[model samples]
Each structure stands twice: as C-alpha cells, then as structure tokens.
Target: MAIDKEKIKQAIRLFLEGIGEDPDREGLKETPDRIARMWEEFDRQREFNFKLFEEFGDYNEMVIVKDIRFYSLCEHHLLPFFGKVHIAYIPDKVVCGLSKLVRTVKAFSLRPQVQERLTQQIADFLQEQLNPKGVAVVIEAEHLCMSMRGVMTPGHITVTSALRGIFLKDLRTREEFLKLIGKQGL
Candidate 1:
C-alpha cells in the first residue's frame, strides 16, 4: 500500500505543535511537507522487484559487492541507523545484476530492522533465488539508539554477518571473504 504523504504532513504539523513549535512560522512551515516527502521516499521499498537474480546461469565462483551504504530507522527508538552492507554469493545456475544486489539490500534496509536478521534475510534471498553454492552478507552499523540515548557509546560499531552453504561449511572460504572486506587483510 502506498504511504499517504498528506496524512503524514498533518501528523508532522501536530508533532511540531505538540513540541510547542509554531508550525506556521517560516522556518517550520515547510517542515511538514519536507518530512512527508522524506518518509514517502523511505517507504519506496515495497516497489522493488528481486527477480533480477534470475539472469545468469551455472557460474560457480564467489561474487562480492562490498560497502553498499544504507540508512534505516531503529525499531526500538524510531531513530536513524546508518550503515554499510557487503554481499557475496557463489552462483550455481543464476546470477544477479550488481546493482540489483544493492537494491535488494536497500529494500530491506529501508525498513526498521535488527542488524542480524537483516543480514540473514539478504543471504537467504540470494540463496533461494540463485540456488547458489553459498551466500554471505555482512553489515556494519551505528545505531542512534545507543549513541544518542541509553549508555551513549559514541564510537562503537555493530557488525552482523550471515553465511550459508559452502560459506558455512568451509572456514577458509569464509576467512577469505572476511579478509577481503578488511576484517583481517593479508
């Protein structure tokens, strides 16, 4: 379902008013519309198609796309969590466009998600669609929930990774991937 921008604008107006800000003031007048536009764009994930993974055949080497940047809201605090995602797959009979992999990551990251589950979802989708020999996803993020609230640990980063098939079975292959992403570069 499409998000109603007008409804969000109304809510933003009420939010500003609730915070004792004058919504009609010049600086705040357009804030509601701007916020509505931002959220409308954020909710565009429902429009992506993941069938792009079906375009390649029987190629069995690891494919990796590293450091795709994304931003999302934390479900617990409803604040921003920005991060980078790295994805890899070993194709058995199908492969996807490099941009499609980025888009797939964006589709999920745009929603409120826990880092670990999001990593697994990306790996699982690629594994299911490509039936690859293996799939891997790594995500590193900084959550406002911790940095702006709670214990307020500013420099800490959270890392989550998911591995399937050969990546799960072979330590060397997993190590290679971890090294390539600069976890233990050699």
Candidate 2:
C-alpha cells in the first residue's frame, strides 16, 4: 500500500507531544518530515526491479549469497533489529542476479516484521520466482527490544531459517549450507 506521508507527519507530531516534547522545538522541527521520508523509502521496495537470467550450460548447482546485512523494525515493539541473511538456492532453469538477492532481502526487511516470517518469505519468494530445485534462507538478528527494554538482555541473537524443496528433504544439503555460512547449527 502507498504510504501517507502526511499521516505519518501528523502521527509523529502527536507522538512527540505525547512524550512531553514540543513538536515546534528547534531541533524537533523537521523530525516529522524526516520520519515521513523514511516511511516513503520503505514503501518504495514494492517497485524494486528484478533482473533474471535463464540457465546456461549445465550449471545447476547450489548458488549461495551470505552476509547480506539488513535492518528492520520489530513488529511488536517498533524497535530496530539488524541482521545478516544467508541464502542458498539450487537452480532449475533460471538464475537471479546477485544484487537482486540483496534487494530481495531489503524488500522484506524494510517493514515491520518478525525474523521468522522474514526468513520464510525470502525463501518462498525465491522458490516461486526461480522455481529452484531448492531454496534456503537463514537470518540472524539482534533485537533492540530485548536489549533496550523488557527483559533487557543484550547481545542475544535470534536465528531463523526456512528450507524448501531439496534442502528440506536432504539432510546433507542443509548441513552443507550451514557449514558454508560458518555455522555448525542455527
């Protein structure tokens, strides 16, 4: 859905006032506009252009992209969570551009989301788009909600994974993916 910048601006203003801060203050004057712009950037991910390439030769092997860094807001708390995503796919008849993989991560991460669903959505999107032999996605994130409030435990990383097709059926395939991502286990 399209973001309403004006509504965001209004909401931010009210939020500032609710928190006992003057929205008209010198330092806070442009905060609402800045926040609205951030929402616009996040909403623009739906239009991301994807470039695809058909399979060449007999090159059907596990293609992996690791350490794709991303920042997202936790849906429950609206606090930030930063992470790295590791993706692996065995192509069937199509291959995707390397940068597109990074874009895909951003497309999902630029919204209020949980780490588990984010991992699954990336794997599912790749599976549907490429019709791959298999797709694997692993995400590890540190949630500010846990560190900055509530239980107040810092340095805890939550790891989530989604394995589809061959990766789900083959134990060795999953093991190799974990090893390549420098993890003995998730």
The best candidate in terms of lDDT: 2
By summed lDDT, the worst window of 10 consecutive residues in model 1 runs over 46-55
Provide the global lDDT of candidate 1 against the true structure. Answer: 0.84
lDDT string for model 1 (1-186, tens) is 687889989999999999899999999999999988887887786467666444467567788999999888888877888889988888887777888888888877787788878888888887887778898898999998999899887777899889999989999988888888887532
lDDT of 2 by residue, 88-116 (tens): 99988788899899999999999999999
For every candidate, C-alpha RMSD to the true structure in Å = 2.4, 1.1
Q: Which stretches in model 2 have alpha-carbon errors above 4 Å?
A: 55-57
What do the candidate models score in CA lDDT, each in turn? 0.84, 0.92
Question: TM-scores of all models?
Answer: 0.88, 0.97
